[model samples]
Target: MHDRTPHAAAAARYPHQSHASGPLVDVSSPEGGPGQHGNTYVQGFGNLADPLAIDGFLRIQEGRVNQFLQVSDRRAEAQRSALQQAADRLSNIANNIGAILKLEHEAIKKQLQEANAKVDEAVKARDELRRLADGVNWTGSAKVSDQEIRSKWKQLEYNIRSLASVLAKCQTKVPSDKLTRTRLDEVSTAWRKLLVVDDYKNFLIGAYI
Candidate 1:
């Protein structure tokens, strides 16, 4: 029979077994290097270098775009300012022209009134002279000779011709065209010459007497 007891003659030949001990070899390294420590450091490379650099480039591009926008905005503002200034200037010029036109109209009205007054005064004088002459009674002179009467008639005829010349000068014709500044000066000169009536003056003398 086989005995399984712990203390036997075969067990006495081998002592009690224990754990083995030795310096562990680093098999991964060709050259024997330092042993691995408990603490480990790992290094890894991801995509491109600095992500912040790419962000910076984008910001720069954005800045350029913003500068262009600012320039365009300023240009538009300048154009608007110029147009507004021009409009204001034109409006001022229009106002000034209106004022000048108003003054011209008033002046023309006053001139026409003066001209009418002169004409009325002349008519009144003529009428008064005619009435006075009709009221007076004429008597024939006994001493007046035929030659003297003929001489007096000749003088009266000469005076009549002179007065007719004056009346012709005073009368004016309607202007047919729009008068410019230069032409207005000419018209004024012509009007001034029309005020003197030599023919009318001669007629008044004879008719009144």
Candidate 2:
């Protein structure tokens, strides 16, 4: 379509992502041309003219049908644009989600490292307290906080799985919205003509089907 925006760079990079390509013949009546009840007609279809004159007359006739082609191209291009927009929108959203998940994953890893350090510190302190009690008859409980260390370990485990699940989900969502056609047997009549149907099947409908 002349007035429509050209496909964006990102969309252009994925031309094969479009489910359909090319405009179809519309065969519908023109807006203000001879097809308006045939009141207006091509200039010289019946005239016995020279070759150049016949070509000139054919150009005039072609003008009448050009409207249908233009309108159909515009409509088809609009449909393509809508699908591209959907894919772009979904990808952008998923990318943003992935960025967030990455940050959270880093935070979770840091937390796990800190939790492991705390566990090691607590184990050393408790061992030292037991050694001192055995040497000097001191019987006080160890001061290292076991509950606090376990809580941190539990939180670290939870965050590890949560971050992994988030990344997996983002990966799954980002690539599924692209336009991909597996068949064309049920496409519209005008589109079928462009596809050149043969024996109740359009060759474009994929042989695997």
Each candidate: what lDDT?
A: 0.55, 0.53
Per-model root-mean-square deviation over C-alphas = 17.1, 40.9
lDDT by residue (1-209, candidate 2, tens digit) is: 43344555535667666535454433346564445334424334435545887899889889978987999999999999999999999999999999999998997777566645645554565555555445544357555466765665555445444433333222122113223222332443343353333432322232211
The TM-scores, one per candidate, come to: 0.40, 0.40
Angstrom error of the Cα, residue 198, model 2: value is 67
Angstrom error at residue 80, model 2 = 2.3
User: Which is the leading candidate under lDDT?
Assistant: 1
